[model samples]
Target: MTSSNGLSSLGPEGASAAARALSLPAESYGNDERLEAMWAMKAYNHAEVYFNLISSVDPKFLKLTKMDDEIYTKFRETFRDLDIKVLDPELLKSAEAKERWRPFCNCYEGLVEDFNFGTLLRLDCREDYTQDNSIFATRIQFFAVEIARNREGLNDAVFSAKSSKS
Candidate 1:
């Protein structure tokens, strides 16, 4: 079957053949664990970009506007609807889990329709790469929480914490 992007869906045999052509190990391509790892890595990279963008701004100039707060509230409700504990960093690995979260943001606009994936945040959690870490979150989720933090003077605490450790 052809997808909306006009890319034909590859069945198992075709996928395996494609993987072979690309010189990928059979265990890596189309493997759930491997796919999850790739998703996590991609999310992490995206989050890092967002963080750098936020950090580049002067904290005093980063106050959230009314619209930012509204976005944040909308995100909170989205999480609530999904039965995901708000602010608990957990990677939404399944298509179903991601589908429930992505509509709130234009993260995938101009991208393929089947491109569904997102991250979560656990700021209180340690910096390790474990699921508890907050290093990965959906683009909009990151913006919502971080914008709220900036407006509420929470980033100051984070900055202080980082400076103290240095």
Candidate 2:
């Protein structure tokens, strides 16, 4: 899809088109090659915060983590009941699908309101990236999924191995 500035929603190329449309200085746009790297860093920072929160084992977070687990387990059924596409990366590429998923993804309502949905990133969690495993999810989805993983002991092996090394 194209933005109002006539740029394809394909990251750097889109940003370049926006910069040109707005008559922005070349310096202002920085290195286009670095945009994805910067986004990855942002995602990493968010994950770090979530991991720290889970490490603390805060009661509210623990409760939410349990809820996230249940939600993910019943994801397909939830989508069916809501009449939306079941968790597919392709489905999340459109604004309409994002809106459809918004109600179910309201765990972080404040961040959701403030975030740019169009810039949502895809994260592939599998050993190999595939249509079924790669997820085009909002920032909140990453947090929810990771939190659930931590709470359900899925991340224990990694942490335990790390601690063993130390």
Candidate 3:
């Protein structure tokens, strides 16, 4: 599945279909290691906070769950695998990252605007951000929805193509 650009065929057909269904093949779908790093830090922070809250005097106030932490961790790893380099550590430590990655901010919006699921999911996760923690849950939500849609769409596309061919 080598692309015309000579990149390995973006992995496998199933993954390709998932990418297409997510509308991520055109952009925001490739190697993005830096973004991955930032996301990892943010997710770790989010999980840590959630765990502490769920176990402590403020558990009622935080109301976080192990499931929430798991999901965040999964998304963090997935984004890490992207190998994106949008936000360098030094750059992130700068004032610009602070302003740009603020909670409820759409800095990563550019990364997932191609698809409805991704966009919607981004919005959903923004609700969890704080001034101190800036990992965008929306990105994870968007990825999950996009991936699900991709799988479903791939099955449909293949089934239809096969039927038409027969």
Candidate 4:
């Protein structure tokens, strides 16, 4: 986590490099405080895990770094495109994962009108802070979470089926 300089965890260049690696505009992502938080939580290791996934796919520098350089590269590109302000790998992955699962959620809502305890377990919950009114936002947030959950379920089902077939 600590950069080569040893003054800060990510020195000025290292932070900027990390930001650039995440593809944020200058001064956009991973401020010192957020980096500090990541260090505190040992999120750096998770970032490394993600980096490994990317490395397996790309392998641009297979012998140079232990980390997955490719996934880090994708993260950079995505963060830049999304204009994300925060610098947490899990949050970024969650957002990315949400996109993949959104469609399954949309389909589930129209087909299911009732919920039981098991039904509730299949919902994806999200907080909506951007609504014009609190009531609408809360309602929409709940709906969105449920849809997200359904999408996730669909994804799991598909993945399981594929694995079984293989």
* TM-scores for the candidates: 0.43, 0.39, 0.23, 0.17
Q: What order do you get sorting by TM-score, best first?
A: 1, 2, 3, 4
lDDT at position 54, candidate 3:
26
Misplaced by over 4 Å in model 4 are 1-8, 24-100, 104-166
Stretches of model 2 off by over 4 angstroms after superposition: 1-37, 45-100, 111-136
What TM-score does model 2 achieve against the real structure? Answer: 0.39
Query: Which stretches of candidate 1 lie above 4 Å from their native place?
Result: 1-32, 49-116, 125-131, 135-137, 163-166
Candidate 1: count of backbone clashes, pairs at least 3 residues apart or interchain: 1
TM-score: model 1 vs. ground truth: 0.43
Output candidate 4 Cα RMSD.
Answer: 19.1
Clash tally, candidates in order: 1, 0, 9, 8
Task: Please write out the lDDT profile of model 1 over residues 6-112, one tens digit for every residue.
Answer: 11245567556544543444455565675565455445555554444344554445644435656657756665443322343343545675676568656434432
Better of 2 and 3 by lDDT: 2
Best by lDDT: 1
Taking the tens digit of each residue's C-alpha lDDT, what string does model 3 give over 1-166? Answer: 0114211233577445433444344256365774444334434444444333322332222212223444345444544442122223433335764453343234334444421221111111212323342323344343432233233232233234334655
lDDT comparing candidate 1 with the true structure? 0.49
Best by TM-score: 1
Predictions in order: lDDT: 0.49, 0.45, 0.35, 0.32
